[model samples]
Target: MQEFELINRYFKGRGISRRDVNLGIGDDCALVTVPQNSQLAVTTDTMVCGVHFFEDMSPRALGHRAIAVNLSDLAAMGAEPAWVSVALTLPHADVQWLEEFTAGMHEIAEYFNVQIIGGDTTQGPLTVTVCAKGTVPEGKAITRSGAKTGDWIYVTGPLGDAGLAVEARKQHLDIDPEWLKKLTHKLEYPTPRVAAGQVLRGYASAAIDISDGLLADLEHILEMSQVGATIQADKIPTTEAFRQSIEGEAKWPYILAYGDDYELLYTVPENHKAMLDNKLNQYGIDAVCIGQIRGGEGKIDVFDGEHKLDISAMGFEHFAEDEAC
Candidate 1:
């Protein structure tokens, strides 16, 4: 299929139709309106065929993930997602694949009320890049540099299930069919904590979405805020399938360093702890406090009860010598 025809049929005029988008797809430059008293939050992510996902991955899931990850970044900044532009590269236009892919993209975009503005489609090796935009009240966007000593650390939900899914796929480990299904779903269709992020704007001192592993992403906050932390290893949340499948030294990387779980990792000050709890509970958000910030310069100490465990692995880095995920 031709590029313009492909976009016109599958992407343009689909998904959520937002009033803020003055001009959407088919235009040379899409126009959008940023709300008054708000700042525009923008983020972009690129996923390649082999490097980011298996070539055989579902087109629908890839479409969902492409949008979800970008939204996750906006969510980290406590921004409400508004619009996205998707640039797609493909070997050829497969009709069924495009249908499933656009369906996935539109489904999530509709859920978040995001409109697809404009982007380019070209013939090449498979790759998908999405640039997402959102809005946050002026001076109300959460950031890594806002963390403070004495702030409580929290995560919106469990971690390591996605890591486990990746490991299982790579190692071909013998996993139960049902458990594998659940783990694989975590890796594919991740839920961005959009509402919880908005709720955290007034309460959280610092916030980040766990796209990279908890330790790796938390380090960003510590380095930016110039504060240290002590994380209770046992308090780190995990799924039942993850706990049942891996144990001991084998489990540490997935739990602490492996990436792809898109939950939120945030911090709240002592005085606002009760208020944060009440607010999260009221919104039915399941957040867990795992540690506390301390006075230091970008250090994180992990403890399993009284024992200080030696952990050296950081999260996934694209160019790191030893990449875990």
Candidate 2:
């Protein structure tokens, strides 16, 4: 089927008036109206087979994640997702795979109220690219540049677990039934903190999603905000679920460098420290103050009390086919 006509079929099924869509489907671009007094937040992300995922990965989860990752970007900016355009590339159009993919995509879109508005399709190696749009109150979208010198840094959930899960899958590590099943799913299907992002709107000084690893990604926030911080490795949440997945010696690699954990990392000024519990209460999520931002020249200090772990400051660089261990 022709890509434009397929898109036309999608719009036809929706049954909504075209007035809501000033332009859609076929054209140089698609246009939509954002009502006055709203801020528009748009994010685009791409995932490649083998690099971002593996051949054994579920078609459904891939579709869900293809959009979920983009939505997480919107959440980092404190935006409520409203629309998404999926630009999918496929080696061949397998109807069954497409159906499962769309099902997965719509599941999260409906759950988060994001509409499948418009995008492009192409023929290539399998890659899912999504550009999601969201809305926030005018001037209220959280940015990575707002942290103050005295603010405290925070992360939404356990770190390193997803990274550990990935390594487990790569190495085909065998472990207790209960533990192996849990970690495998974490790697295959990540949960992004959409609710926590909504609640964090008013409280956070600066925020970003940890798509990259902690050290690399967090350094971005500190750089933009002109601040520094001491991140306690001990304070970073770790669980038996994570611990059981790894042997003790290789734990540091998973904790420090593996990427694809979709949790949110934010900074809060000292005044809002007391409101941490209240801030996260509505979302039923725990917000941990992992570190504090300071006035030092832009450098992130990671420590385990007194010992500092020597690690690179960046996460997985997309074009680096040769990975440094």
Candidate 3:
């Protein structure tokens, strides 16, 4: 299919229509308005065919993930998502694949009330890049550099399910079929914590989404904030499926180092703990506290009860000499 025809058929005039978007797809430059008293939050993410996902991944899931990951970044900044521009590259367009892909993208966009703006489509190896935009009240956007000593660290939900899913697929390990199905679903359709993030704007001292594993992403916050942390290893939440499928020492890498959970990891000051808890509870968000920030230079220590555990691996990094996954 031709480029314009492909976009017109599958992407144009679809998804939520937002009043803030003055002009959308089909225009040379899409126009959008930032709300008064708010700052625009923007993020971009790209996923390549073999590097980011398996060749056999579902087109629908790919579409969902492409937009979801970018929105996750906005969520980390306590921003309300407003719009997205998708740049899709393909070796060739297949009608069925485009239908499924657009369906998935539109479904999530509509859920977040975000409009699809203009982007380019080109011929190449299969890839998708999404640039998401959002808004947060001026001076209210949470950042990684805001962490302080004596702040409490928290996560939106369980970790390592997605990592386990990837490991299971790569190693061909024996796992219960039902459990594997649930793990795979976590890997593909990750929920960006949009509402919880908005609630955390004033309450969280520092914030980040767990796209690059808990330790790796938390290190970003520590480095930016010029602090350190000590996490209770046992307190790091994990699914019953992960606990059952993986045993003993094998669990640490997936739980601490592997990525793609997409849950938010944030820190809150002691004085704001009660208010933060009440706000999250009102939103039906069951956030778990796992650690505390300390006065040090960006070091993270893990402890399983009284015993200090030695951890060498941090998280996923592209172009490293030894890339895990």
Clashing pairs in 1: none
Q: Predictions ranked by TM-score, top down?
A: 3, 1, 2
* TM-score against native, each model: 0.95, 0.88, 0.96
Q: What C-alpha lDDT do the candidate models reach, one value each?
A: 0.88, 0.75, 0.88
User: Candidate 1 versus the native: TM-score?
Assistant: 0.95
Report the Cα lDDT for candidate 1. Answer: 0.88
Candidate 3 RMSD to the correct structure: 2.4
Residue 120, candidate 2: C-alpha displacement in angstroms: 2.2
lDDT tens digits, residue span 1-325, model 3: 4554556667776777888889888768999999899999999999987778877789999889888999999999999999998898888777888899889999999988988887888877888899999999999999999999999999999998998887788778899989998999999999999999999988999999998888889999999999999999899888988888889877888888887989999999999999999999999999999999999878998998888877885444322223312
**Predicted candidate 1 versus true structure: per-residue lDDT over 171-220, tens digit per residue:** 77788878888999999999999999999999999999998788889999
Q: What global local distance difference test value does model 3 have?
A: 0.88
- Predictions: Cα RMSD each: 2.6, 3.5, 2.4
Candidate 2 residue 12 Cα shift, in angstroms, is 6.0
- Misplaced by over 4 Å in model 1 are 1-4, 314-325
Candidate that would win on TM-score: 3
- Tens-place lDDT per residue, model 2, 217-290, is 77888889888878877678765888876655366656656657788999887788778667686568877778
